[model samples]
Target: MLDGLIISIDAMGGDDAPDVVIKGLEYFLKTTGKQRKARFLLHGDQAAINTLLAKAPLTKARSEIRHSDSSIEMDAKPSQALRRGKGSSMWNAIQSVKSGEAEIVVSAGNTGALMAMSMMILKRKQGVQRPALAASWPNEGGTSVVLDVGANVDADAGQLTEFAVLGEAFYRALYKTDRPRVSLLNVGTEDQKGNAVIKAAHERLSESQLGLNYIGYVEGSDISLGGAEVIVTDGFTGNIALKTAEGTAKLVGRYMKDALQGSWWSKFTAFLNMRALLALKKRIDPSGFNGAVFLGLNGVVIKSHGGTDAKGYANAVNIAIGLAESDFLQTIDVTLEALHDEDDNIGFIK
Candidate 1:
C-alpha cells in the first residue's frame, strides 16, 4: 500500500546476468499473485534485459530500464571497482537510490564491490563509522538478527555498541518485536570470556538506560538455541560464526542423506519420514534467507546472495519491498535518536 515505492535492481551484477534476474521478477509476481503498487527500475544492458524481459510480463509492465554497458567483475577488488565504477550496472543501480528515484536498492553481486559502491554513493548515516551487514538467523523459536557479518574486519567498543543499536532497529522493524533481548556473541556465556572490545560493549549495553532488554552474553552454540533475539559481534567473528553454522547445517543434512540411503531398511524408514524430512529442509533452507541488509546506510540497500536462483532472489526482493513499505529507515532514525538522547551519547546516530 505504499504510495510510490520503486525498487532499483542491478540486473547485470549476478552470476546469471539478466536471465535469473528476470526470472526472479516473474517468480515474485507468480508467488505473490497480487497486483502491487510498487514499481521496478532495472540498470543493465538494455538489449540484454529486453531479451529476458520478454518472458516476464509482470516485470516488463511495471518497470523501466537504465542502460549500462558494463558490470563489475565478481572477483574485482573494491579499489578497481570504484575507479571504474561509472557506467556499470551496479553503480547506476545505486545511483537510482541516491537520486531518490528508488526507495530501495537490491543487488545480487560481489559483496565487497557492492558495499564499496553503496558506501561511496549513499554514504553512512550520521555518527556511524562503518555500516554493518545485518542478516536473519533461523533461531529455534523464530528468527533473530546478527550484525557486523563481514562489513568490517574488526570493530572497537563504540563501533560494536553502534552495531548493536543498528541491529536492534533492524530486528524491531522487520520482526516487530518489542524490547528484543540483546546479547553479545562471545566464546562463552560468562562476562569475562570475550576480548576487551566485546567486554567493553557488554558493559555499555548492560549499564545503559536505553530501554533495551540487554541480556548479556551468548555462545555460538546458543545462537540457534534461542539465546537472544539480537546478537551483536564484530565483523570478523560474526562472519566466521555464520559460515560455520551454515557449513554445519549442510554437514548434518549430508549425513542424514547418507544414513538414509545406506541400507534397504534405512531407505524404507527414510521413505516413511520423507515428509518430515522435507519439512525440516524447508524450515532451515538458506535460499529463503538470501538478503543481507546494509545497516547504518543513509538509504535502504540489500545484498542478495551472488549464487541465488530465482526463488531465492524473489525473497530478497520481497524483503526490500517490505522494508520500504514499513519505512524501516524512519524507524532506525527515530530509534537511534531516542537512544542517543537517553544514553548520553552511548548510542551513535547523532
Candidate 2:
C-alpha cells in the first residue's frame, strides 16, 4: 500500500463535469480505492463540487477541494486556452503535480488544451526531445501499449526509439509484463517494406543494448490480433489507427445488436448464447482502458475520455493510482539514461 498517495483531478473538465467526476470517485472508493487507500484533490468551482459531493459519501470523505472559478472549454484551442487558462481548474490540477503535492493528475478535458498545459507546467523529462502520448489497445491476448497516438504528427528515427523506451516502461508498470514485445507499426512486416524513417527506427532498436523485446514490425490488422505487446508509430499514423479501430468496434457492435434482434429465430439463437455474448461484450468495452498517459513528462498526467461515463472515469482513476504507486518514472529515467549512454558509446548523434 502507498502512504499518502494523492491524485489531483480537474473536476469540471469533462462533459459531465462535477457530477460524473464525483460519482466516479465514489465508485472507485467502493471498488479499488478500498485496497489502494488513495486520496484526491479536486480542482473546480467549490460550490458546484460541494453539491455533488453531498451524494458521494466516500469521495467526500477522501477529497479536498481547491476552488477555481474557471475551466477550459472542451472545444477551446490549445493556443487560446494556454493564453487564458491561468487559475482554471485544469491549470490548478496540473499545478498540484508540479508543486509535488500530488503524485499524479487526471483530466477529462480537451486533449490539446490539457496537453498544452501539461507541457507548460510539467515539461518533458530530461533527454526527452518530444514527449509521446500513449494509449492501451485491447488485443486477443490482453492490452498492448501504443504510443505517439496524437502528440507529434511525425517523428524521426530517434523520437520513435524514445517512444519505444517510454512505452516499454509504461507497459511494464501497468500490466506487470516483463520485457513486453515492442514492434513498429508499418504497412507490412518485411524488412524492406516501410519508408526510410520506420526502417531506421527498426534498425536502431534491433542493434541497441537497451534490453527491450524488439520484435521488428506489425501490420495494422495485428493491433487487435495480438501481434505485439507494445506498438510504436509516429503520431500521424497512430492517431488514424486508434480512431479507425474505435469506429470499427462501434460498427461491429451495432451490427451484432441488429442481428441479435432481427427475427424470432435470430433472437432465439442469441438467447441460447447469451452468456458467451455477454462475455464478448465485456472483452471489447473501450471504457475498460480509458486512461491515456502522456509519457516522457516530468510528472504523470492521465488523459481520460472527454465524454466518458462514471464507470470509465473510475477506470481512469485506477490507472492514475497504479502509476502513482509504481516506479514508472524511475524506470523511464534509468532506461533513458542507459539509452543515452549506449548512444554515446556508439558515437550515435541525436
Candidate 3:
C-alpha cells in the first residue's frame, strides 16, 4: 500500500510552489489506481499548504503536513541554497528521508540545490565515486536509462565505470530486465573513437567481470537505437545529449504542428491520422517523462524539472515512488558487493 511507501514532499519548491505540489499529489492519487496504498509528508509553509490542502482533499486525506518557516528561492545558486537551506521545506523533506520517516523524497526545486543537499544530508554510498542523475529516455526498444545527465560535470575513467554500475542497478531495479545491455556514449561506435578518459573507461568496462552486458561503444545516434539499455558518460556530455534530444523533440513537434495546421488539406489529413498521432504523442510526451533519479546516493531522492506543472510533478513523484517501492538502493549495494567478488574471481581465473 502507499502508506507503506511514504513520500516526503517539498511543498515550497518549484515555480508553482505548494499549489502544484499538493494538486499534483491529488491528481495522481485520485486518477491513479494505487491511491489507497500511498501516503505523503508535506513540508512547507503551514498556512499556504493548508490553504491548498483544503482544495485537494484527497491528497490531504493521505498526507500529513510539516511546516517550515523558510524556503530556498528558485534563483538561488546551489551554494547559496545550501547556506540558506536550514529549516527550509527542501531541507525538511530530505530530513524526513534521513530520519527514516519517509522512504523517498521528491522535489521540483533547484536541481543543483537538490543534488547538493542530497549529497550533504543523505551522503554518498560507499565506493560510489560520484552520484549520477539518470533519466528514462524513450527509444525504439522502449525506455532506456541514460545517466550522468547532470550530477557531475566531469568524470575520469574510474568515475565513469562507477556510473556504469549505478546505471546497471537502475535498469535492473526499475525495468527488471535480466542482463540489460550497457554502453559508453562516444563519438563513434568504433573502439578507438573518443577521448583518453572514455577510451580508458571502455577498456575497463569491456574487461569488467561485474556481470554487466557491456556492448563496447555506442555513438550519440545509437542512444535511441535501442542497442543499449543503459548509456554511461560524464555529466558534461550526458547533459548536452539530454538537452539536445529535448530541443530536437520540441523542434520536430513544432514543425509538425505548423505543417498540419497550414492548409485545409493538411488539417483534413491530420484529422484522419489523429488517433495514431495522439497515441504517439502520449508515448513521447515530455510531462510523462519529467522525473530523473539521483543514482549512487544513500537515500532515494528524485529531482523534478523546476518549471513543471502538476501533471509533470506527479510524474516526478511517480519516479520517487517507484524507486522507494523497489529494491533499487539495495540492488546497487548488492551489485557492488558482487562486482568486487567477481573481480577477485576473474583475477584468480586469470
lDDT against the true structure, each candidate: 0.85, 0.92, 0.85
Error of 2 at 275 (Å): 3.4
Which candidate, 1 or 3, has the higher TM-score?
Answer: 3
What are the models' TM-scores? 0.93, 0.97, 0.94
Question: What TM value does model 2 have?
Answer: 0.97
Where's the lowest-lDDT run of ten residues in candidate 3?
Answer: 341-350
Candidate 2 residue-wise lDDT, 1-350, digit = tens:
12389999999989999788888899889987788779899999999999999999989888899999899999999999999999999999999999999999999999999999999999999999989989988998888788889988999998999999999999999999998999999999989999989888888889998899999999999889899999999998999999899999989999999999999999999999999999999888888889899999999999999998888899999999998889999989999999888878877655
Return the clash pairs for model 2, or none: none
Clashes of 3: 4
Return whichever of 1 and 2 wins on lDDT: 2
Q: Which stretches of candidate 1 lie over 4 Å from their true place?
A: 1-3, 33-35, 263-269, 342-350
Which candidate comes out best when scored by lDDT? 2
lDDT of 3 by residue, 1-350 (tens): 24567999999999988788888888788665255476899999999999899998888778898989998888889999899898999999999999988999999888899999999999999878679999888888787778899898899987888889999888878777888899999888887699989888888778876778999888787676677999998899999998898888889888988998899999999999999989978876788888899988889888888888788888888777777778888878988777657546655221
Better of 2 and 3 by TM-score: 2
